[model samples]
Target: MTTLYRSLRVLTPAMSETKPSVRGFHGKTSASTDLLETVGRVFLTGRARAHDYMVHVGIGWAPARVPGFRWSAVTANVTDELVQWLVLDGYGFHQAYFHPDRYVRGQYRERRFPWPAGGPGWYVDRAIDQGIGRALWFVAGTDPAVAADLIDGFAPDRRADLYSGAGLAATYAGGVERHELELLWARAGEHRPLVAQAAAFAATARVRAGLAVPHNELATRVFCGMSVAEASEVSVRTRPSGPVGGDVPAYEVWRQRIADEFRASGRA
Candidate 1:
């Protein structure tokens, strides 16, 4: 083991001699590692409950100064912390900094971790876009056509990580032009890949269990696992509002159908 692991085991109250750690985490964690281990396993199996699951996942999200901390001590600490925090409340875990409850009114809510630079947003891509990406997200409201530019502008090497974050954010904050979707498509440029990724994550929460669940607490948890095609099955596909044909949206019907398909096929 690295010196980092040895020191962490001796110093921190996280290490365990008996309980198992998560797959990527180093050494066993505390004897109370059970819940944390379950959360880690769920996360690893991709039932992850965060927006930026693909990019900011694993020990790297909150890495120790020690090189490649996942192999040992970093794992124990992170597992313990995540398990405890998530048990208390699962929101905002993807963010490196703490997030207050959205409705809470405290000065601390506005405060953020001061490190990692770029003020909690991807300054690198915004720099490349000359802030147009951020502007587009605000104005265009996450229509995949327009938002792909935000993802596409990344340096080829950083594209995966950068685009994944951008994609999830757009999905979470969805607000496309309700009336002009077709026109927007006509105006859109070819940035299909990132658009699909963002749209899928965004669509995850709108439907489940043969029903449409809009803005509901349970609906909010349906991210990071379903794909665009799978999401299409679950969502109504049409805009969510308007004089509707049924209680559920078209997308939700599709989502239910997909769910049935999965059940029948016994794959997921």
Candidate 2:
């Protein structure tokens, strides 16, 4: 533990740098999972605790920090692949938090987001929107009505992903009461399945980390009509066998499968 702490202190900056020989970080067998989890933690902590501006840049540096990392690598860690994408989620949150006028108000999007450059690049925009949706949770101060309005302000095509992100935030972060989550469920309407899918993802994160809390249960019940364990099962059972061929990434297919299961079960 002492060595890990010291290593983290010295290599902290490398968290946001591209392929800088993160020797100490890589020394651990759990480095891949640790790195991805830390990226998400940095963003959530930055927004919820530090209110720091530079963490956004660190998130941008995330993909590069990993040596020879690729989106396809997610297939190898099927259970935790969702967390891998949280790097983009962190980036999206920071963009919205720091430059709300441009990202939130103006609704601008980088047609070609040039980072971690490679195949499956087309999915970057959607992944970022998921983060933007999570940011809306904080931007609206955890108010369900305000969150719905903020998402509604976006282009129609983007609202589903925005709601999905918010669902993840509400489930994982858990600031509001159960009634508030219910209100969010009502507002989500047609996108309820997407919201449920993201909430299930959150359940999996919490359960996997042994960080399951009352709010996780509350949110899962409200959004998914199931307990956290059951909701997590929805995520596990619906996972794509491996990488799929097409414009859509396997991650999306996994999410869609979860969403379809929830929709079919009439959870909302």
Candidate 3:
């Protein structure tokens, strides 16, 4: 390896591992993943209201050669399920920072955190924030600088909580740039509350993937280790009782299974 490559390997441990085909970022992506990515591609490339964009991209999306492809076939297939998901996801986009433990909503029932103020679009913006982050993860891969640009490029009103969600993407993407992390911290400005939430998102995924993370060495604490199986269990147990329902359990199963596949491939 070249000197620059060696230096990079030293800096970001996530860059050291090889991503194989079966466990690649695109590997075994679920219906939710495809739908989310579609939403992200449109948003990252242009400005469109969430409902409008979904209808445009998903509605009347007939294949020319397929005889009679239903308009927005996929969306039509999922029906009310997708609409409900978007609303809930939009809600969580804002709730992410307020909830502390962003992943699990069941923990928030007893707390008295107020819903964010900014009119009805608030949740849509937050959901888009997540989509943008996921898109960056898929398209930019491990390039933190590129990811940072994507997040910073958004207009301020897109969502104040964006940096936090973007930060989650950087972690879940499995690599981070020191300068990029610092830039996000700075961009967060003043109290910088959301950055810690980002750290937790990254750390939780790392632990769930069974990586031997040096949790104490980092500024943010990684959660206790959890196997993919354990996460699926928690997800199932936490469902219905919380806001997440419908296809979520199936998605979680697929996500955990794919994660296990990646981990095994990494070991190989």
Query: Which candidate should be chosen as best, given TM-score against the real structure?
Result: 2
lDDT, candidate 1, at 101: 21
Flag the better candidate by lDDT, 1 or 3.
3
- Compose the digit string of candidate 1's lDDT tens values, residues 164-197: 3333444443333333333332232332233333
Model 1, position 93: C-alpha lDDT score: 25
- Ten contiguous residues with the weakest lDDT in model 2: 19-28
Q: Which stretches of candidate 2 lie over 4 Å from their true place?
A: 1-84
Root mean square deviation (Cα) for candidate 1: 18.1
Which structure among the candidates has the greatest lDDT?
Answer: 2
lDDT of all the models against the reference? Answer: 0.32, 0.69, 0.36
Q: What is candidate 3's lDDT per residue for 1-268, written digit by digit as tens?
A: 1232222222221311222221233332354245334433443243233233123222211221123332133223333322333323333332332232332212222122121122233334344444344334444343445445555555565434455555555444434435544654555553144444344434544454454243212323221123333433433342333335443433233324433432443310
Question: For candidate 2, lDDT tens digit of each residue in 31-139?
Answer: 4334334534554333311322123323443333334444333223223343345557666866765566688778888776554444468778888898889867766
Answer with 1 or 2, whichever has the higher lDDT.
2
Show model 3 residue runs off by greater than 4 Å. Answer: 1-122, 137-145, 159-161, 177-179, 212-268
lDDT of 2 at 80: 35
